[model samples]
Target: MTLLSLSGVSFAYAAGKTVLHGIDLAVRDGGNLGIVGESGSGKTTLLKLLLGLERASAGTVSFRGAPLDARDRGFMLGFRRSVQAVFQDPYSSLDPRQRVSDIVAEPLRSLKIGTDIAEAVAQALRDVDLPPDAAGRYPHEFSGGQRQRIAIARAIVARPALIVADEVVSALDLTTRTRIIDLMRALSTRTTFVVVSHDIALVALLCERLVVLEKGRIVEEGATREILARPSHPYTQRLLASTPRMPARG
Candidate 1:
């Protein structure tokens, strides 16, 4: 089933400054999709549209076969519950003042899920390979990778159906990046993922299908391996050539 879709979607910041144009895309339930582009490619803008942070100037955005309706409280609430996001820069994404438990439980509190919030938080931490006691600490107490793990914990606490991750590992070191990617890969078994990144190789690791954008429009969309092997667009070829190759695992 199609969980999220954009048809003929176009967006503009102002009367003249259009950011995205005629974009059509969709993700099936439990699908893993990657949106890849460099800065100014409208990747983030497209993400904003998908998240309902911005509305399209020209097309339709739909979730579960229904058009996105911000005015409909019921639809908005259900959409919020079904879709969750993990952003780039875990250090900044997490609150420094809030305890880890509170950070992870915020979604549950806001969504009013009715389950035991404490148990959900604890399970989220454990799922991310963090110890139970880590919940009592602040975001600053952990390493970069651990902090990202905490952020992941927060994202998964609600058992969201779709996860939109934007540049999630761009700020981490190689070792930490690999570990986080592996963690996300494992999580994909139970969740649909929309991974947005400038790093094509990293996206290749997590997403089976990829959509390459340039100048605010999709330049190529296909299977990850096919695109990697035979890029049809000049921009895609450049993107692939410029991205550093991932190191071989032992």
Candidate 2:
């Protein structure tokens, strides 16, 4: 079943300059979709629209066939609980002063999911392979990969149906990047993921389908194999060419 759908979506900044036009995309339940494009391609904007952080200038964005409007407090709260976001920078996204447990428990408190705050935080840390004691430590104590794992754990703590992972692994080192990607793949068995990234190979490794964007338009999209093996669109080809190659395993 389709968990999220965007139809004929268009968005423009003030002064009538359109950034996205006639965009249509659907993400199935538990689907891993990777959206790739150059810096100005509106990938992040699409994510904002999905998260209800920004409304579409035109067209509609829906979840479970129902429109997503942040004005409805009930729906907004429910959406926030069911749909979560793990931002690009873990260090920036988290509060430096707060302990790890409080950071993970913030969503539950805000959404008022349940009273078992301690249990929720503990299970979340464990789900991401973080030690129970790690919950008491601050963000500074963990490495980059570990911090990102905490971020992911925070996203899923409420049992969100969909998680918008915006560049969740981009800032990590190559070794950390691979490990985090593996962790994400393992986690997707339960929660849906919309992985926003510009790295073709990273997306190729993680996503089931690919959406190639250029200048705010979807230039091409298809199964991961087709897009990677023979990228038809010029923009897609450029993205693939620009990727830094990692040494093949022996």
Query: How close to the true structure is residue 174 of candidate 1, measured as C-alpha lDDT?
Result: 92
Model 1 spans with C-alpha error above 4 angstroms: 246-250
Please report, as a residue range, the 10-residue window in candidate 2 with the lowest summed lDDT: 241-250
For every candidate, C-alpha RMSD to the true structure in Å: 1.8, 2.2
For model 2, the local distance difference test gives: 0.88
lDDT of 1 at 48: 91
Expressed as tens digits, the lDDT of each residue in 1-250 for candidate 1 is 9999999999988767998999999988877999999999999999998898888999999999999988998998889888999999998999999999999999999988889898999999999999999989999999999999998998899998899999999999999999999999999999899999999998889988899999999999988888888889999989988987653121
Best by TM-score: 1
- Per-model clash counts, in order, read 0, 0
What residue pairs are clashing in model 1? none
Compared with the true structure, what per-residue lDDT tens digits does model 2 show for residues 113-220? 886999989999998999999989999999989999999989999999999889888899989998998888888889888889888777877788889989999999
Indicate the residue-level lDDT of 125 in model 1: 94
